[model samples]
Target: MAILSALRLTRAPGAAFVVMGLYWGVFAAHVPVFRDRLGVDDALFGTLLLGSSLGLLSTMWLAPKFDQGLGRAALPTAAALLALAWIAPSLAVAPMAFALGMVGVGMASGLLDVVMNARVSQIEARSGRSLMNANHGLFSLAYGLAALASGVTREAGLPMIAVFGGVGLLALGLMPLLSRAPAPAVAPEEGGAVRLPLWPVMLCGIVVMIAFLSEATVESWSALHIERTLGGGAAQGALGPALLGVTMTLGRFGGQGLAERLSETAVIRVAALVSATGAAIAATAPGPMVAYLGFAVTGLGISVIGPMGLALAGRMVAPHQRSQAIARVAVIAFCAFLIAPVLMGGLSEAFGLRAAFGAVAVLLLMILPPVLALRRRAAAPLAVPA
Candidate 1:
């Protein structure tokens, strides 16, 4: 019965990931509409998107408290907030209103991100399993399906509000699943939580930021690149992100199987190189089909970085410090979301979109040295916790 309970509980985190992915997938599909709705150019829209990150940053400080205070309740509550907040951006008519709506979305997304990841870490610790990749795979699958569906819906002439409203309702429907899951057990070592070691944690945070920045660049900007730069139609442009999502889903499931055979360092190093190569291909792709292939390659290569990084962070800390440790790393990593859109928008505005993509390739390659350093240090005898 205990084993069965564990099996059942594991589904909660994956479901949460899917719900969040659905929101993002729909958002990605509707970007052109969003831009037109607010009457902003790419650069201005990027700046507006920064408001969500600001809101995320502001609310991140509360993550640990939520984890400590709410326990299992935290995930559902944050998810519910995310569901409601997702509608705000869909309702906005002006720039300020849109920005304000993004703030709410960011706050909710940030909270949900931290809590759900923490729950997954706890689940892995208890189950002695590598579940991160699989859970994230579910996210990518949902994202891909949602993006494709949204494209069809838009082509069918459904209003954005109606589309987004359905997503919000789906999230509400998933809330009950969380209630059925067991709460994570706090271990003895974690009873009195102490300060997590700053040096390694900071290093891990940097790695996560680089990974997230690379991934977000493609996910957020690829559609616009396909449509504006490559002259793809709406359905074809939507295919860019959708294809990325599909490949990422496959890659993460592959990572789940590989985790036991390979070290996190090994996986990340190879993944980064592959991601850089994919970025380069994307930067030079002359046509939409070629660009789609590039994005798909990029997705497959970067798929494991975020989940693996979070899993590594979880392993480094005491069981009790899981939520707080993951939160700290996430706060730093999520800043990529804050920076990537604006940076890419400015770069795309100044140089071409191709140039902007080239910069992403450079950023991905930069992870190699850090990954090597981490592997070397991890090989040494541990005097500190992580």
Candidate 2:
């Protein structure tokens, strides 16, 4: 019920999340095709994918400005732009063109991601509700559905353009839902940028970054792992991400209540361990069914980490700096998207997807140190310099 209430309260931002989920879901399910189209190996495909980070990195400063300048329209505007930008990758036939297309995708995705998360923080502060998990749950739900559908279409031999273009149209149609103005909150200063807390933000950002890297691992490579490594068909490969989406939805929706009962750090600590175990299982799995079980476990554990990190960062800052703090953490964490393609690509190319996933298991453990640091500072007053 709280999840439903939170989703209702943050409908506009939730819609933005859903749109992102749909686009990414479709993209994730179709990675093999995209790579095949360019006729490149995993290593080069990963490098080319890194180009999107250039676009994402550029938004670190621009996102805060967009929040201040556009006010309520910021999230929807970014979503609309993303609708147009996501179509480019389907059109790209060469490695160079694909790389450039990813830049466009990254730019649009970065802008929307920052604005929507910041908006959710703004609403949470005003409504005094734990909304992040619920909103993210909505995204996961949409992502699963989209991935399932994309798999069906791919198996039917549908054109990439038709699939991506249809997703864009769906995103465009959701613009009205995402267009609502924000709940009243302290607006950032119009003329100058506010300084965000460096150390605390970085600590939380790293946790989020690791979580996202693990997430990107599955999103970008899980299908290939299932189909190639486990000898699954196209539909079975799609189920890899689809299962993650489903479990994440359950985990995040459940997290709304879990956050109320437990400390955010505690939840994240246990979550990290759980997710690590799941990744390990996935890495060692010999069959698609075993892999599915591993992925399901990973999704449930990882679902709450990023949301909790952002929620913690928001709590640590002043109201006016919430957007900036979210933006900064997002900038740092989103670098995982950049790192994932190359890291996972190289690992899978050399050692295989199993080793690459094993590395994800190791990476999940890295969240524990930051969890300890955040707990130590939990009682400290907000002490960041202006």
Give the number of the best model, judged by TM-score: 2
Residue 98, candidate 1: C-alpha displacement in angstroms: 0.7
Compared with the true structure, what per-residue lDDT tens digits does model 1 show for residues 83-167? 8897778989999989999999998888887777668777776777666677778888899888888888878879999988898
- RMSD per candidate (Å) reads 3.0, 2.4
Q: What is the lDDT of residue 330 in candidate 1?
A: 81
Off by over 4 Å in 2: 183-197, 316-324, 379-386
Q: Which window of ten consecutive residues has the lowest lDDT sum in model 1?
A: 1-10
Across residues 109-175, which tens digit of lDDT does each residue of candidate 2 receive?
A: 8888778877887787688776778888999999999998999999999998999889888877888
Question: Residue 199 deviation, candidate 2, in Å?
Answer: 3.2
Model 2 CA RMSD to the hidden true structure, in angstroms: 2.4
lDDT of each: 0.82, 0.87
TM-score of each: 0.91, 0.92
